[model samples]
Target: MISINDLTFLIGSRALYDEANWHIKPGDRVGLIGANGTGKSTLLKIIVGEYAPTSGTVSMSKDLKIGYLNQDLLSYDSHLPILNVAMEAFERQNQLQKEIDELLKQMETDYSDDILQKLSNKQEEFSALDGYNIEYKTNEVLAGLGFSTEDQLRPLNTFSGGWRMRVMLAKILLQDPDILLLDEPTNHMDLPSIKWLETYLQSFEGAIVIVSHDRYFLDKIVNRIVESRKGKLTSYAGNYSFYLEEKALRSEIQRGEFKNQQAKIKQEERLIERFKAKASKAKMAQSRIKALDKLERVEDVDDDNPTVNFSFKFTKTSGRHVVRLENVTKSYPNVDILDNAEATIEKGDKIALIGANGKGKSTLLRIIAGTETFKGKVETGHNVTTTFFAQHQLESLHLDNSILEELQAFAPKHSDTELRSLLGCFLFTGDDVFKKIRVLSGGEKSRVALAKSLTTDSNFLILDEPTNHLDIQSVNILIQALQQYEGTFISVSHDRYFLDSVANKIWFIEEEKIKEYPGTYAEFEVWNSKRVIPPSKSIPVVPTKKEEKKPVNTNADNKQQLKKLNQDLSKLESLIEELEKAIKEKEAEMADPEIFNNQDKLSLINNAYISDKSALEKAQQDWETLAEEIMNLEA
Candidate 1:
């Protein structure tokens, strides 16, 4: 529950919000919608107390707890395991457990009434905080976000930026705040995760305010829409579809009013010009002029939103069969992502890869694109020029290069003017083209990647999660461009609307097998809904027999091992803390103007900072390992 009253935010000469007022009640599901630069995200930050409004007040309940999922990936200790990262959400619970453990250890030596009382109190506090169920809840949330069981134990640094964002989302969800402020929450999630999120939010007790470009997701989760435009906010009561219809009707009425107002102003101007010269009518002319001056001008209505206009051109046409795979199999140590999967893609075919996360959809696409090694017969037709866009393509960008320079590398022959025009279509205009890739937001980086992918001529396109950070208008424009493409493409996307619009064929991957269906996404959904699909039988099962236990060590021996491990863990933690503090101090020093002004000093500090961060990460990993070993010994 929150209330924003007469809020006004300004940046330089530009006004993002002018006297905007809105109220969010309990259980309200509100979707924030606007063009890319209309301050939708900025408004969310204001509500979350990250940004202060230039004028007016934002009031919330005193007991309200807000969970915010930031658009940018926050800095983290890379060496920490993801499970520990998620556990950070339960601060009080973790503290209680730590106290309980320490108290128990103290009681083992003291055997005093005071220690026993403290231990009893801590145990009661732990139970009240649901400390025992923390592991179960953490595992459930992580799995729902597409993390494998083994992945929870892996260090955070091993995952890509997108996956790291999912880790952040898991932390926020586990926090269970009274309100949720999510910005493009589904950008990094696969279809299965998105579906799970939708279901989870449906029963959420608190209010939610989300800024998303996923239309289907908005339709499924939001019960209200808030549109920001012209430094003002307007509220509509309904889902996204209902909001669209209502907005269209409002725009139509506004257009009529604007036209009528323009006509009246023109008539008055003509009358004033004609009568002002005559002495007899001068008074009347002055009256009309004053009236015109006092009247408020009507704002012109935009018929349609701005969109990108670009087309893909192929250097040469491909043969009848664009791609073919025979008995393709991709396997890891103990898991088979794809087992003898077979499929044939004809020329001009637009296929959509759909399945649960980690079910070989991307793997299949990689095999076809010749990026991954597989045990199978894979062949591309004659004259087929393939271009592949990986899911983490944005991260692969040269951060030191300007956006214009990045595109120029792909198209060396194109003049600056032509490249600038191309960048304009992707919403990078004027000085934006000169910005280094490192300063760009996730969505902006994604656009640069998409623009670069279109530079070279290719007949077969293989894209993974291409629409992850795209806005609705941009996605529509991209869909229109792909519709007119003459080449074949295979894209893996979780956007149901995008698939429905672009996909002419469906490749469903399940249980390490690919099932091909010849139809649109709607048709595929219909057939899937009608049929009673059987459970997957390919999942490997372990033997039910229990293993023979080894002889247990004596209590004294176990206690000694535990004591050594605890000492190691304590030392490692102390080292990690010192490294973190040093790194922070170095970073603060580097941020000073004098430090950056000196080239030699700046370089020295930068190197030291990097070294310190690396040491900190290693120390964190060592600390985690020692702590786990201690836990095992104590158990």
Candidate 2:
């Protein structure tokens, strides 16, 4: 569907892509992968026309439709119900409906034959556009992406960034584009949502390019692997696991060639040096020098995976019993998290907490950290010093402090040199250690927070969504760190690969109670999937076929509400744009070192950010108030 040839993209004097070529045919499921800053997301933007190649062109059919989902897409929000926002995907249908509505209003005043004819024409066009099924398609896509019927009626502005991202994805999916470009699409998804998306994409008819660090996801959804390495797109003909094997074979061959080539080159140099001084052999020496200069040297293989190179040490050891929770109960405004839930962590236990969203995985982690309120008995084992790393803690880092300084402040027990060595293992090199936390990307900040977590002499750790924004390389580094850790830890994550690599036990919450399986995530999945099957009987998944979607009818009330939405759509769009812009500005100001230093300025900036979001929330509430008349308006 798309052809990329001899593409070269430059950033300043650096080449992000150099004469890279790729062809995406129909139904190509490509997994684009590389280290952070290797331009995976940038390449997606280039395909979507948001960015242009510095040299070369991306050509495709004129009628090609592309759907792109990225972090920036989350900036879009509206006070309209998510259902209506998703309905906006039917652009031509909406226009036709509006014209038909205008014609109907005209007929109400004067039932002219001309008005009647125009109304009939518009209605015919709307039907031809499949406008009758717009609501059905939107609702189906939203539900598949893990939204409830009630959630579809709630305003887009009321959802958090992660949820709003799903709404955006629903809109994109409803568009039914010829190709989809998803960047880290699973970063915000839970296990169930990820599985749903995987199944959906497996049935998709069009091409898809996914950039994600979730290897299990890639293995499930993709048939081809494309590595963005050395400023080129190298194609692999199978899933990620296959690519690993193929790449290893290629690396071995390259290493051999590199070694032989280096030896030959050294021999040629030695011969030239010995012969150049003699007048009789001077001419031959020049010819040999020229031949050596013209030789195409082989590039040595670079290690993509970095491991633990620094000594990981803890000053104290915990007792045999790391932690004990008895009769823990916690609840929220609408959902009950725990009802006398009980679980335990023992010395050297590596547990993975996983479930669908709103299952209170993070809440449980907090209760263990002693940072959350609960009505239960939580006992900590003796000599247990703990370190907790959560996404929210990334903001707790001193914005003005350099990474080195932040680690120094947190790890007073370690000397500057020792901390520096530790940071290097986390991929923070010489100058990178001096970068202010304010300027670090999400992945970079995650690394710094993780580095700080290791700085503690604590033997017990709790990490929440530690792999959320990290690239595969960063995730690998984290895996190495976690594997090398001698203490007990409980990590909350949706990454199955990460869990399988580090977790010895799996913990999940169900029916407001904690459940445990004493095995790796892969083992747990196998057991869970077959939990209901009899031991003698086997699951017969024969002749598997996907469920077909058919057009469904919408109720009359929703039709009226959808029509009425046209009048307020533009106003809501404008308001959302302003709110998003204000939020970004306030956030940037809050990150300013000067503002961070001045307590008053920091408070004012933080307040402004909160106020901007609150205003957006108020706008959403207004939409909710309208929703009885807008969403699910049927009496």
Q: Which candidate is the best by TM-score?
A: 2
- How close is every model to the real structure, measured as TM-score? 0.77, 0.81
Q: Give the Cα-based TM-score of candidate 1 against the true structure.
A: 0.77
Candidate 2's C-alpha runs over 4 A off are: 109-113, 412-418, 532-635
Over 4 Å off, model 1: 78-80, 109-121, 307-312, 391-422, 430-445, 529-635
Clashes of each: 0, 0
Q: Model 1, range 1-635, lDDT digits (tens) per residue?
A: 79999999999988899999999998999999887898999999999888999999999988999999986655654688999899899999989867766775676689888986776677667656766557668877897888876899999988877789889989999999999999989875788899899998898888899999888999999999999887888999998999999989999889899999999999999999999999999999999999999999878788455443444555688999988889988997876888888889999899999987667787788789888899989988899898898756788899999999998987776667767766776678799999999999877998899878766688888988877667677777668767878888999998889998999999987767788889998899898865535334432121112223358778887786777667666777777788888987976776575663344685687667755665675566556555665666676
Candidate 2 lDDT at 236 equals 98
- Residues 332-414, candidate 2: write the lDDT tens digits: 99779899988889999999999888789999999999999999899999999999999889889999999999988887878
**What lDDT score is found at residue 536 in candidate 2?**
13
- Cα lDDT of all candidates, in order? 0.82, 0.84
